[model samples]
Target: MSLQIEMDDPARPDVLALLEEHLRNMHELSPPESVHALDVSRLKTPDITFWSVREGGLLLGCGALRQLSPEHGEIKSMRTPAALRRRGAGRAVLEHILVEAKRRAYTRLSLETGTPAAFDAARRLYESVGFRECGPFGDYRLDPYSVFMTLDLRPQTE
Candidate 1:
């Protein structure tokens, strides 16, 4: 399928609507206590950069990056629409975020994904794209229902 990718400010109407839809879906997956969708207000934080993927005029998925430090960044709010889940939208959005992180000179990228059953597909996507399990970073601590992953962007010699 032909996909149009857009890296946009969260203020864009289309992006904001899709983000809301994504969070709604998350809320249904786990209890309110376990749901981890960052609030729309949080995405407005100065540390974050958001992007959405569209197929023709349809928003397929969205993802964001949060600058943690000069050399570190975190991935957040990654979601593929229920209809678009298996069609590569997640991969496209993720690769787009990784490129953006590197463009901003972040040498390490990390993320927190729910450990609930509904999150299995998400975890697989991360692993297939080279993210490896890591301990909690930032202000996160060990949680039974949260899986942490990280990717090192620095070059390494074979």
Candidate 2:
């Protein structure tokens, strides 16, 4: 299936609805757990940028990269819509984000995901993309429910 991913204002109604659905489902997989789901208002902040992945007329997935500094970024709000999972939408969206990060000159990209069984698929995706386990980078503290990861983007050639 053909796919197109583009950076859009996270405030867009379609993107918000997709993110909300995925975030709600992710939280429900456990209990009332805190997993750093950025609200629409927080997502609209300047430091964070968002993208949506769509195939044909269907929204497949969405993700965001928040600028931590000139050389680093943090992956946020990554989710593949339920109807679009297992069809390479997640991988497509993830690779697009990584390419975007490198294009923006980010040397590193970090992420925090859950430790529950519900996250096994997501963890595999990250690992396949060269992300390795790492310590927390931002304001996060040690939490058993969360696992941190990072990937060093290859240097761009002239």
The candidate that wins on lDDT is 2
* Candidate with the greatest TM-score versus the true structure: 2
**Each model's lDDT:** 0.83, 0.85
lDDT of 1 by residue, 39-158 (tens): 778988989887778788787888888999999999998877666677788898899888888898889999999887888888998998799999989988787878899999987789
Error of 2 at 34 (Å): 2.5
Candidate 1 wrongly placed segments (more than 4 Å): 11-13, 31-33
Output the TM-score of candidate 1. Answer: 0.89
Q: How displaced is residue 108 in candidate 1, in Å?
A: 0.8
Q: Compute each candidate's TM-score over C-alphas.
A: 0.89, 0.90
The predictions' CA RMSDs to the true structure, in order, are 1.8, 2.4
